[model samples]
Target: MTSTPPTRRREWLAPAGLIALSLVPVLSGAARLTQLSTGATITADNARFFDSPVPIVVHIVGSSVFLVLGALQFAPSLRRRRWHRIAGRVVAPAGLLAALSALWMTIFYEMPASVTGPGLSALRIVLATVMAGAIVAAFLAIRRGDVRTHSAWMTRAYAIGLGAGTQVLTFVPYTLAFGAPGPVLHTVLMAAGWGINLLVAEIVIRRRARAMSARRGRPAPASVVSAPLS
Candidate 1:
């Protein structure tokens, strides 16, 4: 029986951490906070937008589609063929709709104006923009046949897209540690959650690079290369 290499071990760490972290909200019962009766929910007072039937329908459908496609990113075989292409077709449009709907929802929905202040709004817009950009970059990279770049960008994008889960995970520990009440605590936690996801993606990409380099053996230094006789 062969033991896994150190590089493979390192590569597994982030996804394993994310998978475990993703379960915290459900296990801790933190998701209940989002319910209407929880009295801890975030929403805008613009009932026309928050309570609008059309946006809600779009939000549900788009988010569901994005979640399914995002999960497929973790499956290497599924990401390698025509099926991946078909999935991409579905993912791109759905993801865009999800992001747009979410942005709109955030705008119309009121939280503690202190919590949803201009800075927080800006951060949400930035996250949404980055999410959209990542999807576009992933599609373009694949079209150019740069699979490594494609995978890296897509993973980052999907990670950001799945950030609602990360946010919930962050809130539980933060609330426990700080006794959550202040807007500052919530803002800090949300930012930290997105930061953690981005960091995880970066770590995964770097580990993959290291593993590939190890598999190929480090190339001889250019300074050591002898020129052909002129």
Candidate 2:
């Protein structure tokens, strides 16, 4: 049996759920491409989306790759076989591109379904910055052979990237209950999305650490790389 430094199954479950939830946005994003290819009439928000769609598209594609492939890294068989390292190389850059594109979209393009007032704009900037930093730190830590730190930082970045998935859980209930959310509610809910994911990441991280301690009779490294949940 595997020691619990990172029990693969428990780590796998979280990202599996996240990936499943994220499909909602991924399918919507793909439809945008289909509509573009077929010369469908672009009206309303569709028109705005096309006006500056590159960044959003990049973000969608990049995050899909990052989130899905990153989850696979938690498989003990794959991780032991060194597939985790190979996947991390791709995931790291994809995450960075997603963050950069998100930053660009947040700065220049105005999303119609949501508001980008000063408060929300600032929130986006800060989150994007944190995401970027996390990616860089993960990359650097691995280069130094610090798998523990790399995992933790990668989890942090992945949590932020997974906010799209969490937002469905957080914000959609309101739309179902009432109607479309106003700008304030939208901003508040979106912020909650990132907060919730990060909070989940921390909980998972700590839980794994405790489990590792029990299984190994010693604590996991202070900054062990988190399971691929993020």
Per TM-score, the best of the predicted structures is 2
Residue 184 CA error for candidate 1 (Å)? Answer: 1.3
- The whole-model C-alpha lDDT of candidate 2 against the native structure comes to 0.77
lDDT of 2 at 101: 88
How large is the C-alpha RMSD of every model relative to the true structure? Answer: 8.4, 4.7
Candidate 2 residue-wise lDDT at 2: 53
Note the Cα lDDT for every prediction shown. Answer: 0.63, 0.77
Candidate 1 lDDT over residue span 166-185, tens digit each: 88778877678767647666
Deviation in Å, model 2, residue 139 alpha carbon: 0.6
Estimate, for each residue in 99-185, the C-alpha lDDT of model 2 and write its tens digit: 998888878876665454337888888898889888998888889987667767877898888887788887789899988787888
